[model samples]
Target: MWWFLICLAALIGGYFIYGSFIERIFGINEKRATPAYTQQDGVDYVPLPTSKVYLVQLLNIAGVGPIFGPIMGALYGPAALLWIVIGSIFAGAVHDYFSGMLSIRNNGASVPSITGKYLGNSPRHFMNVFAIILLVLVGVVFVSAPAGMLTNLINEQTSLHLGTGAMVVIIFAYYILATIVPVDKIIGRLYPVFGALLIFMSVGLMTAISFSGEHTIMPGFQFGDMFSNLNPHDMPLWPALFITIACGAISGFHATQSPLMARCMENEKNGRFVFYGAMIGEGIIALIWCTISLSFFDSVDGLADAVSHGGPGNVVYTSSFGLLGVFGGILAFLGVVILPITSGDTAFRSSRLILAEYFNLEQKTLKSRLMMAMPLFVIGGILTQVDFGIIWRYFGFANQSTAVIMLWTASAYLIRHQKLHWITSIPALFMTTVCISFILSSQTLGFGLPMQISTILGFIGSVAVLAYVIKVAGKHKNLSHSDKATDNLTRIT
Candidate 1:
């Protein structure tokens, strides 16, 4: 209980501190003139109200990762709680806040654009390519995992014969409706109602599971046991942790949310509320999932059994509605249906933005529309045949690598602008070191990559980008001068 309280405090404090820093470094004055980036008037680039922006940002960033990552992390037992708390604060929150703020300052550009600005054109292209590939990969797994869970849940609870194809259709329909509809008319009304119902369902299910007196099977592995029992084929702990943290860490999805939401900032001051606030909310979601997993299942085998034997759905359903009886179960079903909608809309919108930017197309054109939907449809089709577990792992690794590159870009920006505070740079350096080490170790261990081929390629990609960033940092001589002038004015005032 005390640990939980401590974790909560850390989450809250970290957001406030890091979010403030991001706002300050980016010169995100509410009074600053809006940059003349051609924003589309419709769903793609239409300026949203601040509240809607926050809500959308929250929903987009919060996905299946928070739910599943914590469960898997709990395999390490209570100690994993420490990682969730600390790593989320230092690694995840910081990555998100700065990434969003940087994108905002760069005229709603994506991370790759921001990278191109600070790095070089070639590196930016590479980063963008990596980001898009990762986005597609992660997007598919993201849709599939939840679909799998939803399928299992429906089968366990009701007589509904929801196949993966049917679920995909439902998701696509929801995305179409949400994207084309006015924000005020749909998301604004539906989110609060749905969010409340979800909370109720989660609480009800958890309470029921608690009172059911079903003892959680505690797996017998000690803290040190995992070290000795490390499968020769498995990657080491640090790398696994790094990759696993990608969803919570920095994700390319943030690139989409930041710029789009930045346009609605009633005041630049609101950046904190939107960027960091969303992350803290996500952390709470993750914590809730962790509690659910830790309290319900005592053993790894128990969890595996729940997932393997069609019990994953029962676990979600039973835990969700079993507390309130039949009505609660019905509500749980509705919540499952809604959860994917939030993420699916995000993916659709993000793909649209990436394509619009890639080809320099007007956002509303038929070409942009077809371009956006095509990738999603293609990815969805591929996901139906692939092993999602393996795909998700690869996505996770790719996400972390992209995040590290973004962090490097941000650090370079700060240094060039003479705002390179130790608070930010220290964590940035630490995360970068951890990520690089993890990627190397993953190759060494028989995790993937035929004989370090992938590792070598990733290394080359990273170095080329780093060298470009260094060159850009050196070349941006005027940035330091401008920052100094601003400081001088501040002191005079």
Candidate 2:
């Protein structure tokens, strides 16, 4: 109990102190015109109020992630506490803030654009493909997850019967509508309502846990007992836990999503609240789910059994239902179903913008938006029929892999300007190791290699990446000087 309380306190305190330090490091300017103002196109680049942008960003990055991801992460026991708190403060929030600020610096460019400017053309092209695939996967997963939940709700609570296939069509229709319309038309208007539900459910769950009696509900998880793997499968904690908990900790997907809000932000200073602060808000939500999942079950084994039997949805449904009864059922619907739908829409929206930017097409008109969006939805709709677990596992891997690229890109940006680069550099190196090891050792992707060999490969990969980044930075510096010398000689001549 003390450990949980302390972790919660630290996260809240870190947001004000550590978050402000990051803000200073980024050197945000109040007077400079943002892309939303200078490049307002009445479509994707329209300016939004600070409050609206903050809410939309929060809900956009969140989706069903904080709920489902943390529930699964809790399979490792209280170690999740450490990851959510530390990762959110040092890694997740920092990743999000820098990514958003970088987008603003680049005329509201997508992640691939920013990556191209800093990491060069080849990596940018790779990232373009990687981000588009990840977004489409997100769209598929969100659609399937919510529709399945809605089907379950109807079957469980109502006499009116609806199959998942029907729900899929209905949800996909709404997704297409949201994706093709103007940002202000669908996402900007509805996200606030969904955001309010998220806040209400998180706070309500926290309150329920607080009052449910310490001995029974709050089982007093300790920091010292956190290291012993509570997972029934004895899953390695290094990469699996990190990948399982991407959203509440550090996610690459946030970088793709940030550019959308970046296009709407009114000022550079608001980056902290919209980008960094929204991540902290997500961390809080993930923490609540983590705590509730652990405390609600009789033991770690019981939680694991529930998850194995029914999936993370079981945790959401059982915990919320037990704690708040009928009201908890409603909260589960909002948290699990409504939230992901919101994120799915934005995922497709970001995909549309990325495609528009890639092909150099105007998005100011409906015809152009529909032309880019129809193919994405067709693929996403096809994907909803594939196995959900496989899609989710790949999404998690791609999510962290993208984070490494974005982090390195940010590091290169800082290095080129001669600012402190270690902040992004250290995390980039760490996540790079995690992603590489997960690939080499994961049963789904890799050969399920031994942990020792995986660790060794991770070490080599991290070193190689760091060497490449340093070499590139040096070349960029030299190129800048060479261009400067040429300009000087030409002026003098």
The weakest ten consecutive residues by lDDT in model 1 span 484-493
Candidate 2's TM-score: 0.95
Candidates in order have lDDT scores of: 0.60, 0.85
Please write out the lDDT profile of model 1 over residues 348-399, one tens digit for every residue.
6666566667777765555557656676666666765787667776776676
Q: Given candidate 1, what's the lDDT at residue 377?
A: 61
Stretches > 4 Å off in candidate 1: 25-27, 33-40, 176-189, 192-236, 299-301, 304-315, 322-324, 329-337, 421-427, 433-439, 443-471, 480-493
lDDT of 1 at 153: 66
Instruction: Estimate the lDDT of model 2.
Output: 0.85
List ranges where model 2 is wrong by over 4 Å.
214-220, 478-493
Q: What lDDT tens digits, residue by residue, belong to model 2 across residues 1-493?
A: 5666788888888889989998887787676678888688877888999889998999999987888998899989888878999999989999999999989877899999899878889989999999999999999989988888888777877898888999999989998898887788878888877787788888897788778864254475555657767787888788889999999899998999999999999888799889999999999999988888888886678789889977998677777777787868677555668888889988999999998999999988899999999999999988988999999999999999999999999888778766788888888988988988889898878779887798789988987988887778757764475324422311100
